[model samples]
Target: MATAYRQTHDHPKEYFVETDTDTEDSDFDDFVCSDSGKSLDATIFADLEQLFQSQGSEKNDQPGKLLCEVQTEENIAEIFAEIRKEYKPTEAEWRVSNIDERKDHEAASLLDDAFESVSSEVEKSGSIEGCSSCAESVNVLDVSQFKKGQHISMPGKFGTIYQHHAIVCDVKSTSGTKAELELIHFENKDKSIRIRKGIKTYDLKNKQIYLKHYKKQRYDCQLIVSRAETILEDFKMSKFKKYNFLLLNCEHFATWCVNGEEECFQVQGALQMMVDTLTSALGIGSRVVKVVQQLVIMSTDEIAKTISSAIVPEIVLGATAGVYLLYCLAKTAYLKMAYKKNNLCLTCLKITLKEMWLGFLVFSSTSVVQLLIYTFAVPAIGSGVGIPLVVLSVLLSVALKMSVNTFLRVLRNPFGKEKTKLSRPSQLSIADIVAFSYYRLEHVAIVTDILDVNERAQTARVRCIHYGLPKLLAKRQIVEEEFEMNLVNSSWHKFDVDDTTSYACEKRLSRARERVGEKRWSKTNRSDNFCHWAVVPIARWDNYAFEEVNDKEKKNKSVEPFFNKYPGYIAEELRLGDVVDYKETGVLVRKQSKVDQGKNVVEIDLIITSFWKGERKTYTIDLKRDDIHVMYYKPALCISMQDRVERALYWEGRRNRLLWTTNGFIESCILKEEYLDN
Candidate 1:
């Protein structure tokens, strides 16, 4: 009877290395058989030969070579074992090393021992085992342990080899010892931040494969699972944004996964460093200033010894250092204030450092020029003349250096274009009307024809027009009633109609006072008498326009009649007439005014003449106001309004109309016929 043999293990086709072999006449007749008194079949040997030939052809193009020599049955078994070992699966395991466990031993030595022991076990048993030692224990984390929505983080390197946090995602594993891990990390690429997901494979026994679980102390596992689902959903749709290392980065993302809030410890550290640096710099500056002052006083006695003496050099050095120190202090303060106002992060620190370095470079250049001027020119002249000349030279050198830098900067761009600081109120230009709304004043007319933007005060100078029917009517009634009462008492009461009209006007004035109330008049008087003109500190401007007001009408107001026209008549004429034109040559006014009482205050009288058939009549309106508020309106608002007006004129054959509501809102009704009624 012939004994039979069969292959025990199945190897993948790709792992088999095929080669050509001429085995048509090969036979295994002399090979040893099992000790059970059975002889192997000849057909079994033929099948083995064909298997080699088929595998050889699959791996290699040649047809007469073998991958390995198979002279004996034992050699064939060894080849199959080698193939099975090569295709064995790997797995991932992790363990936490506590400080107490490794207190008596070195961490590096412990890690080396763990790696060596794991290698020996894998070589002998063909599988990794968990360690029992307290210092080097290993816990194998199975694929089932990590759910789809579980959040895990690992330490990794980002830009310039700086350590950052990376999130683990899309974990996979098979029954074999191997496990696959996909890591998602943020990288600053091409001047922007991007999410990069990468896959890696690890063996269970590999000491380098360590994972840490990120759990929130406040939340339970159920809540964590719920939040994780939402976070993972958001992560899938998240896109790359501009990288701000101190504002948003990988560490922030990882923290956000566990907790709802995003934060980075590295950025906090950087900000703390910036604060310390600024505090130290300011302290050093103060000390230097005091020391320099002492040095200057001490060197005054030795100044006349020689022009090349150490005293003159000390003074020069002290002065230059003092100025540079002052500049640094000021620059640092300005940057800190700006960053705080904008709520920016540690990026401003880097910018502040760069600006300080540039300032130092300029200071050094100025010093060099001063030294050259003193050395070359001071010695040629007498000490009496050279002393003043050297001092002048130092000052002039610094000034010239600064002037040249400014000139170069202006030449480089000429326009001095810069990103506008959004925190600061923008400047308003001439012919811009802003609605002044604050306190008791609601939506008052604040016309800025001769506008002045005071950046220091954060305010603007505006010519305010105050219109009140009750107040104007009261003033006119008082004058006309007194005139009529004088005529009635004296013998000058001419006619019955005139006496009756005067009496009616007096009764109307009394009724108006009673109806409008004395408090309103008293408030209006306080505003007109004491707080007529004001310098208002502005936060910002709301709506703005470049509607042109007739300059001639404003200037000629003082010469026209006062208190002769009714308030209603004046309001109607202003609404109907072309007092506010939307077409004029505009100017960017940058003048600043002093906050003085009764300064830049003007009362204007507007006169409108109308002719119907053969009849001619004139109407006069006196405009005066107190408690005027002003603010800088953004120039962009003016440009936008100007464009809208031009478009409305081209399409609708009319100008943009402005209507002020009683509630203090200025409505720009562009090409709308209905709003003209307001």
Candidate 2:
């Protein structure tokens, strides 16, 4: 059974891979399955523990350090430090372990089903009996001892793999004998954090719990609790959907609350263990010889198919790892150069490690999907687990990758962090830069032009050099009331420049508008016009014009896109007046027919403008090498055209940054300083 997804349906592969997401949707739907309710077999870890003990005995190894009982503060700290190191299998043993941890986890649902089937049969025979409850264990955790704003963590059932973390948000009736304690943590079903009172609402039967402690307080627990509370308050108003089991789960919530950063070392270690095992199993390293020999024996078509699919999780993992390596190295090198450091400072190491782990967290999401697909004995078609797992992976990976640029600004701390004081005038004038903080970074924008919509109301034509998907620059019209009052919820700063220069910039912007507006969509009916922004279209064949050629033949002849990095973006397909994503973007020609020119010859003879990248340059452009594409449809939003959007997309996911120009960074940004060396 095949399911067709709309091309615009949310999917992450569209960013890096060229294949139509619609086609991949069914494949993804078939390949990976996720069941949040499914539990890992406790015996898996029990087996690991048993294996470790047996191996220790076989090696005649001396007894290792046991976990020190947490009687004092030092003992608790020692337990955390030691447990992380103890019973840890070497990479070699882990890879060769009979358990095949990756396979087990990737097909956790299938394995759980199998375990259930066996258990059911055994129960029917009455040979195995079980009874369990934590009611008697109520005295174990002293509610009064655990204070508000303290961390509580629970280990996976067998006490080795995953950990769920939460913070004590409240203590009701502290003087009462049975003091009611409230904890906050992300709940998967709701996709938001919820506060629940004590063990009555939380299951604590089959796991060991830990209370985070330090000899010296390492964090402002009160502030941490405050952040978590704020999140809960905000979430009550909206379902944030920021909770994914693998990436932004409870652990990430807890950590972010405490440290102002999302992190999960347990997830990190587990993924590494899985990757190491899979890499060995896939014959990525030592088994390359075997793979090569197998490939050599295959027919040419088969080999071509295997290489082109790029579906092998291990291979994709390697490629992604390479990309992340360059990403991190470039970041570290640039920061070093910025600080002019010949020696590594503590900050350098800290930033590098931060980037490394976060980048890997996203990278790990990609591999998890691939491995999940590979796990279910992916028939030339259907495979493990199901839609839920792949969807979770897609959401996690895309969310994290999107966060990279946003996070860099926050982590770097110097790029656009301006200390110079600037005030927002009571009334915003043209060419003023407006700054606002959203999510993470400080976003800046220049008011291009102000338009008088009617006698009583006016709108500001605001534009920002946004580093968004498909395009870096974005513009829209906002009512002056909102722009001035509370839309941005931040103040605007006037640009300090000669009135003539500011006036010239204002004209250039008007000229830009006039250039594009001449071809802009006109409302069929005479009604109030609405803000125009890009809307990625669905039903490509219906809206886009393409030569009627065999897709297979076209695939071979296809060249790199000039406007957007999205695949198969042919120049022949673009209609006139369409917004184009380009290096200097964009002055789209207004016409009804397609052009005779190919995308490759795209020569820039003379473009006299002061835009970021297209600064009055006369150069020939080869679209094949550089990225350019007719961005998503941007029919001017009007009373009539608005109907098309509403009729087509029930809800466009989002029509969606921070920086100031005075920080000396904009110059470096425009120069492409990092690319200059290359």
Candidate 2 Cα errors over 4 Å, as ranges = 1-145, 156-161, 171-180, 188-207, 214-219, 236-242, 274-678
Under the 3 Å rule for N, CA and C atoms, how many clashes does model 2 have? 14
Provide the TM-score for each candidate, comma-separated: 0.21, 0.24
Q: Candidate 1's residue-wise lDDT over 22-47, tens digit each?
A: 35553334222222222222333344
Residue 83 CA error for candidate 2 (Å)?
A: 46
The TM-score of candidate 2 is 0.24
Off by over 4 Å in 1: 1-161, 170-179, 187-198, 202-216, 220-243, 299-678
Query: For residues 446-564, could you state the per-residue lDDT of candidate 2 as single tens digits?
Result: 45545432323332334442212222343222212223323343543432333432335544334223222111112210001111111112223213222222223212111111112
Q: Which ten residues in a row have the lowest lDDT in candidate 2?
A: 130-139
